[model samples]
Target chain A: AQKVTQAQTEISVVEKEDVTLDCVYETRDTTYYLFWYKQPPSGELVFLIRRNSFDEQNEISGRYSWNFQKSTSSFNFTITASQVVDSAVYFCALSEGTYSSASKIIFGSGTRLSIRP
Target chain B: NAGVTQTPKFRILKIGQSMTLQCTQDMNHNYMYWYRQDPGMGLKLIYYSVGAGITDKGEVPNGYNVSRSTTEDFPLRLELAAPSQTSVYFCASRYTGTDNEQFFGPGTRLTVL
Candidate 1:
């Protein structure tokens, strides 16, 4: 079974400040995919990023970035100079792939981020 | 492209009543999923289909049922409504592959009184 854990239930930061969301996962599969999704107040989930176990390279997308570490089984997301629009619930998910449809994805509890101006 | 569409954005059902949540994807994806989000919690998978005519139970699939008769549609049905089943439901789909990203629908908010 694959399980994802997002320790922080809620986080608050002032606008333009930097914030990091922590995500740790547990999976026995040798190969799997990790994903980050954002759900704003509108209640629609927006796909943020996806990283696989083989690639631990850190990624930076404009104001958003992700650090994938295999040794520690952690995939953390960071926001640089976050704005009010960044306020949303962020989720970490894991999926095992073996070219079979039986492999299902699991999600964490989620971290609710509040950006205040 | 109307990526993933879910019908009945908001619904309220009485106890013992039943309803179906409709989901359709135009992306020609082979994988579709149904998930429910409770208060202060992440989404829990209810059911998923890898392709048409193939459906499987997910983590929390006890109260719900799903059928995939076509590649484009996956509908979730609640047999007997209960207060515990009241939550926001989201439908998503992804192409068959390891790196394919899952596209999500706006979501359906269901309330059972």
Candidate 2:
């Protein structure tokens, strides 16, 4: 079985503040993939990032960064200098199955982040 | 590219009514999926198609049906609509590869009364 938990239901931050959203996952498979997606108020999901199981290295893209720690089964996302445009619901997803078998993904409850400009 | 597209941006259904949500992808992706999002909740997989003539159920497939008769089209069918079934439906598609990144549609908001 595989599960992803996002403890933070909602968070609000003012402009320029840095915010970190926490995500924890559970999976028995040695090979897996982790993903971060953002759903704006318009109700469209936008893919943010994807990381494989073996890659524990941190990733940064402009104002966005992701920290994947296999030891803790945690993949945390951070936003530097947050803006109103960053306000959205972020989800963490996990996939652990053979492509020929079950390659579907399981998603967390999601964390709603509100940024005020 | 149009990527993935879903028809009927919004719809209203009466109890016991049935309707089909249409999805199309021009990306020529081998994998297509249907997910539903409730208010303040993450999307839940309803069904997915690996290729034409191959479809499988996902986490929440009850009360829903899907068919993939063509590579560019996968439509989800809902029988006897219920209030609990009201949600925002999304269609996504991805090419065959290890990367497995999915592109999503704008989503269809369904309201049942």
DockQ of each two-chain model: 0.62, 0.58
User: Model 1 chain B: which ten-residue window has the lowest total lDDT?
Assistant: B94-103
For model 2, what is the error of residue B46's alpha carbon versus the real structure, in angstroms, after optimal superposition?
Answer: 0.8
lDDT by residue for model 1 (B6-112), tens: 99999999999999999999999899999999999999999999999999988899989999999999999998999999999999998876475788999999999
Task: Write down the TM-score for model 2.
Answer: 0.97
RMSD of each: 1.2, 1.1
Backbone clashes in candidate 2 total 0
What digit string (tens of lDDT, one per residue) describes model 2 on residues B1-113? Answer: 88889999999999999999999999888899999999888889999989999999899999999999999999999999999999999998877764767788999999999
Error of 2 at A86 (Å): 0.6
A10-94 in candidate 1: lDDT tens per residue? 9999999999999999999898889999999988998999898899899999999999999999999999999999999999999
Error of 1 at B95 (Å): 1.1
Cα error of candidate 2 at position B105, Å:
1.0
Models 1 onward score TM values of: 0.97, 0.97
Instruction: Tell me the deviation in Å of residue A69 in model 1.
Output: 0.6
Which portions of model 1 miss their true places by more than 4 Å?
A99-102
Looking at model 2 chain B, which ten-residue stretch has the lowest summed lDDT?
A: B94-103
